[model samples]
Target: MARYGMQYGPPQRSRVPLVLVAVLGLVLIVILAVGGVLLYQRLDEPDSAPPATKPSTADAVEFRRVLKSEQGQCPSPPSDTVVCDANGFRYTVGRVELNGAHVTEVKAAQNEGDPTWHVMLNLNSEGAEAFTRLTTDLAKKQPPLNQIAIVVGDQVVAAPTVQSAIPGGKVQISSNYTKKTAEELARRITG
Candidate 1:
């Protein structure tokens, strides 16, 4: 006999409800944590933007080829580096004289009412000298040969021809790039 009443086995409390409560609590905590992280990230940058869509497999392959020839297996300093576009058309551009180290700043800008964006590069003294010479030589070439390709990492973002000497050193690459793409180019060049 029990002290207060008839013994009903043991006070069997169903743990199912407790378990459900605990699981719900855990889920809430996880959601809160994730939300907090996302909020912090957004607040931290304020001007943060989403990343652009990645290039296709063909673009990646072509970019890899360009990087390999431009910076990877070069025997000498700056020579003729032959790179192919996504369409497999090859362009034998001058060697990369001014790399990320030579670039001081990179910015993405767009003219009002213009549907396209462009990347601008501010270079150092050494970069300016080498760039001037490269552009000068390219300008003297024929139609398609006049353009100078900007190879960054495994990507060839732009290839525009030099109209004049470009003596001042600030180079603006006009291209059919989107804002995200322009920002990406800026990141690559300012590495």
Candidate 2:
């Protein structure tokens, strides 16, 4: 006859099931992490819809007089004047000399004597008169004051100084522009 023996600690168990469960959990976590990254990437992409035919009122182009200007950010609570930025400078702009409504045509062209591109705007008769008067007045003033800020929305695309009274309704804006940039600006102005 043989004597019966008792187990001291826990009974023996296979570790295969536990390992399988752990592996499944790790795979689930990996799948969730990958899905999250993919979802984030998809959400970050820009909308693929076409742009609107007409620009909103806030996006309409305008030419304004530079009232006060500085080499840094515009002041808070800009007061009566609107602030515009161009070429690393901030300008306090006043008075709309011309607006998008007066623009008859917009084109991108190369500079006369330079290898740079520019956006050219042809304006209506009323706009021509207004621009002429504005340029005439500004031409007589000193620095910062002599500049005409070409604004699109609240941003200044260019702030060219009035060397002399620019006669006619044709205006050209040059800001070290590439062909693509000039064309893009023309399109924005046209819209």
Candidate 3:
């Protein structure tokens, strides 16, 4: 009771709060130390190397000899990779080049990093002359020379005469090819 007649409330107790504060501080310090260590290790260590490249695609020549159809169709059509008669022939790319204004032979399914599959023709002088004449005719046609197609096994692959005429009867056929396919095309053209 107060002397002035007002009633006084009971005294409030004070709390220490020391142990709670200490525990909280300790936990904070521990978390920070752990975080710093992980960050430092990530930054300091050398980078782990990337995984090596797997041979997802096989060599064109090798694929041709050993290619098989997932569905086992025969006399496979000349598209992408086709297998027929229990054998597979990969239609790889072929390249042609001119040799003294004449085509020599086409280079077939070469591996990556290989020089482009260069094709040269052995067009007899007469053949060379014929090719040149035909090319000129195709160039002058109303439809232009884009229709001039190179046919391989019922497949018309490229029709590129847009740049220049195939001098010496030499031309190139590049595609997703295998060695066997390139060889087969070369054989067919030689005949």
Candidate 4:
């Protein structure tokens, strides 16, 4: 059996080499640290290169959402135009009454406590009459067929069902429009 400080067979390997190797590694680390400090001190660089900062994941996601949500200004179509919704349904220029002459004003508004927004249009006498008749006829129909579609430049921005005739010259359009969508619709209507 091996006794204290006695090898069983071959002489035990000395740990001096391993200790020396660890010391060298520590020395190398110190040298690297000192060299980095010296180089940094020698270079007249900015305190920080503006950090090379980039948008965080949340910021990037928000930016993409904003980009995607942007709706361009409304289009200007000819006086007599026939536009269609995503479905096969069609809305004549007469029905919409946005002939670039009858719409007095268009405004985007958000309902209180509601995330959804809408566009309000102040119409002229002619437009108001046509719009009222259209809404009255649509109110009697069923489902989507009963909805009065607001078409602009081949796009049906809104198609809301009318339960009763909107008598006033002002018309409020609501189709769960976001703020961007509502603003775009208003711009189109006014234009």
Candidate 5:
């Protein structure tokens, strides 16, 4: 007897479309991953944008003697002295021991084995003599008087205490500064 209805095996479905979809998904994931990495790298780079305030050619840098310093608010109408704040302390500054004109070069540099950064100022012959005298006197003093306030445009950048007389004209100002801050300070002083 002949079979009325024909028996057929399972119909084969093409897997090309499914394979294409999977390949496209993989490609998309790789693209997204690469994009994310590139974005992160760009963001991780050091900031090269201009400073908040443009530095002028006449930006003044003064190394002044700290006559008296206190940790509280600065006195209003200071008497025969300039009051400047640095690191939460107010310094009563006296005559300028050194000025910007004495500086020949300024640059930011990192310490040999330290993570902190600093600004180095190279001074002229006159400045070196004056600085030596100032440091020698300050080293013999006590407390606030032993510190020298580095004033830049009315703002005190650092007030480093003098441990001994520095005879050379090379001066390094180190504080709680990052690489960016140190570079900015160098630029401002140079300008």
Candidate 6:
């Protein structure tokens, strides 16, 4: 019964410090939540970008077909890049499989800030005949666009026309490209 204004309920251990600490922790949590929300919004915004980003895989069927065509070419260097051998010979992608081939002793980029390189190719009599036939047929057909694509590994390098019959197995390609590029293409085609 020692009653010195002490109420015998639970002891009120100075609530001021505990309340202040709880309020500070709550404020910090709210600030962190708001900052997180703002950061997320910034990252979601869109920005300008170039178009030519990734390689085209096309349709699954087309992909399979292209893969089949490239398998015979060899994956040792991959179709998208160039390959080379010990010899000085440089290979160029042809218009068709075994129809024609681009052959060159050297591949140098056009000087003065140009990205083009010159390439030469050869075709046997059979290849020339095939090229002529395919081109003639294409001329008659109404197509979106037709090109004789040269394939290196699994990538398309160049594809030109027959011009005439290319019977002499000689043709040239003036590619809009660079020096490193020229060497790369040449290596891939020949190697």
In model 4, what are the clashing residue pairs, if there are any? none
Predicted structure with the largest lDDT when compared to the true one: 5
TM-scores for every predicted model = 0.52, 0.63, 0.34, 0.47, 0.65, 0.37
Question: How far in Å is the alpha carbon of 119 misplaced in model 3?
Answer: 4.6
lDDT of 5 by residue, 22-106 (tens): 9999999999999999999999865433332322343368888888877766556653366555556777888877888787777
Per-residue C-alpha lDDT of model 4 across residues 1-191, encoded as one tens digit per residue: 65787657788799999999999999999999999999988686532211112112211100000001112333345223344455544444333233445556657777667888876666678867876776677677676556554555456565666788877777777778788777766655444
The positional error of residue 124 in candidate 2, measured at the CA in angstroms, is 0.7
lDDT tens digits, residues 28-120, model 1?
999999999999987886343334232222122111112222233432343346654444445565445566555565677777777788876
The CA lDDT at 165 in model 1 is 68
Candidates ranked, most accurate by TM-score first: 5, 2, 1, 4, 6, 3
Query: What's the lDDT for residue 20 in model 2?
Result: 100
Q: How does residue 8 of candidate 3 score in lDDT? A: 70
**Candidate 4 TM-score, C-alpha based:** 0.47
Each model's C-alpha lDDT? 0.60, 0.78, 0.42, 0.56, 0.80, 0.42
**How far off is model 4, as Cα RMSD?**
18.7
CA lDDT, candidate 3, residue 11: 65
Q: Any idea what lDDT model 1 has?
A: 0.60
Q: C-alpha displacement of 139 in model 5, angstroms?
A: 0.9
Clashes of each: 0, 0, 22, 0, 0, 13
Candidate 4 segments exceeding 4 Å error: 1-98
Q: How close is candidate 6 to the true structure, as a TM-score?
A: 0.37
Where is the poorest 10-residue window by lDDT in model 5? Answer: 49-58
Cα error of candidate 6 at position 60, Å: 23
